[model samples]
Target chain A: MSHGRPVRRRGRPASAERNAGEPATRDRILGSARTEFAERGYDKASIRAIARGAGVDSALVHHYFGTKEQVFAAAVQGAFAPAMGIPDLLLSGDREEWGERLVGYIFKIWEDAVTRDPLLAIMRSAVSNETAAAIFRGLISRNLLERVSAGLDRPDAALRVELALAQLVGTAMLRYVIKVEPIASAPAEELIPRLAPVVQRHLTG
Target chain B: MSHGRPVRRRGRPASAERNAGEPATRDRILGSARTEFAERGYDKASIRAIARGAGVDSALVHHYFGTKEQVFAAAVQGAFAPAMGIPDLLLSGDREEWGERLVGYIFKIWEDAVTRDPLLAIMRSAVSNETAAAIFRGLISRNLLERVSAGLDRPDAALRVELALAQLVGTAMLRYVIKVEPIASAPAEELIPRLAPVVQRHLTG
Candidate 1:
């Protein structure tokens, strides 16, 4: 990939370049942003560095993502894209087994390197920076929790969904981020059966 | 609150000062370490800064806590001191209601700003830095999980203890650190009942 080289055509207007239908370029910038934020964290990451990592111009990054916070938001969104199907997954499964399916699905996503990396970056940023935390909070509340809770038939659906999530999120932090032993090294098969029932009780009990 | 001024006695040997049996000074250094680690994180926080914060000489910090990592470990131990009674609490309670007691105890700790602040610092450091994470993992595994698991009758007692912990830890991250909505605002009275059962099941089910 080109590194820090401006790819803009000399005769083309910056606005035209900005509007150009280049999904690949936009995706590349986002990938770079995830890396930058992951490595340097939110406070230290800059538009120039992200552009350099993506082999695009700094101006293009600004045009595509708007600002540092905006760039971080887009990165969080992109990172969460894979897991966005969760609500659908929750709705499709047998209601009694939703806990198993939910736990299984989350474990699958977290177990893979490709998906786990960006999510890890997003998590690290959220824990350390208030701006990043707010963006993450908004997305999770709107995109994930709201949809899942809406599908539930219970009265305290939102609270229940959040509790179910707390179980999963806490497991992920121990198993992945903190790498606490036993929990970290234990196989998913061993954990799912144990965890799913508790989750099921929270959702359907 | 002295800032940066050395409090070493003139001509006194550092070893003699180190062994002076001054519990108050040692506690003050630990408190300062927690604040520095919480504010600057593990990687950015310095021994010099920690000493300065405690209003003690740098030599005294080294004497009391051998290295920056050692200081962090001591600080983590101090922060965790309050929660150390948990294993005893678990052993003392009726086996079935251990979950309620556990959840109640933890929420009480996190709800209080005095106990919560240092823990938040430890968590932030653990998530962001590898060395800090290891220290935290070791401490949690040895001090909390092992003690609790030892009292359990199940063969997978260690894993069970960890899962129970994951539920509370995840809740803490969302409710306290991330401050996610609904979960963040939901009163402890409401959360305790819903969460206690899951925790109970994990421990005894």
Candidate 2:
């Protein structure tokens, strides 16, 4: 499986054993963690199990990620990599148009299969388990909320950021995870216009 | 266990055995179903198990609510009874303050332990399970969306109502279910003012 790359047995740090600058092994471990968390949920997903799924020694999994919580964080970051730059995206354009840009970008992610799958898995696990939810919330706070709040320079920044997020996240839950009708079937063009203003108000007004 | 109210056996029709217009049996069954669904989730909750919880025969559960689906519907209605008359609530107040009223009411439900429990259970189960999610969406469309849309008399009324609902529902998921910070701890007074306008605009703008 290593393709002639030196394979370390148990207890050695993964980074020390792997070829320098090669993230393929780390990526493979994250992939396995994603599947494990999705299938077994947070409480049941174990480092040992994820290592087995990735076809690596359990020690290697620990060496790379340290703990299940860290593994979950890595998986969430990877799953949301497309949207992880939301802070940058929000700051790139006129802040007034933040709503349109934010909604447009999120709608694109939910509409596409490749990006949506990992997000769906993370959302499923998060809703069902407190541990997963903490990780999900942590990702949002660190990657999106804190950054957006910093840019706002307004009172109640945290509350405002969360409320705006709630709107988008809720819509995604209904449209994708729940498969609610109408909103679920409506084309993105129609939704973006209607929802953008609402998001904008939450963020700016 | 039935206290002399003619306990029906497993194979017998439940309604026939009970007195007409007496809803005690029906209410008891619904109560049991709520607990069962909350604890076990939709896919795992069974009529027999619910009957056992309610201290009645399985046939009685089937007789009151035909299937697990119907039982879930009953449980949902009961759990959401406080907010089910949202249309009436909307009409009873000044239409201009609709957003404030709506957000205030929902916030109360999430803040109170009595109302929040079942809702949290439903939200958690729905996010993780497709069956539960479908039921959750159907309830939203029938009870909230249809009524809100009927009052709009605007183009894209359905879409607008859903977006408004998404804001409130998403907030509830984060604050109550996921327990995300700030919004999760902020006083209701602070949030209602901020969120109400957003919802009102979605409805009227």
User: Which numbered prediction scores highest in lDDT against the true structure?
Assistant: 1
lDDT by residue for model 2 (A1-205), tens:
5578566565554654554524778888888898888766676679999999888988878777788988898899899899887888887779899999999989888889888888888887787777778888888888877888898888778788898889988898778877776888999898898888888888887
Going through the candidates in order, their DockQ values are: 0.69, 0.62
- lDDT tens per residue, model 1, A27-130: 99999999888766677789999999999999878878889999999999999998899999998858988999988998899889899989998998888778
Q: lDDT for each of the candidates? A: 0.87, 0.80
> Taking the tens digit of each residue's C-alpha lDDT, what string does model 2 give over B42-81?
6667899989988899876777678788888778877878
Poorest 10 consecutive residues by lDDT, candidate 2 chain A: A13-22
Residue B65's lDDT within candidate 1 is 84
The alpha-carbon deviation from the true structure for residue B31 of candidate 2, after best TM-score superposition, in angstroms, is: 4.2
In terms of TM-score, the best-performing candidate is 1
Q: Each candidate's interface RMSD, rounded to one decimal?
A: 1.0, 1.7
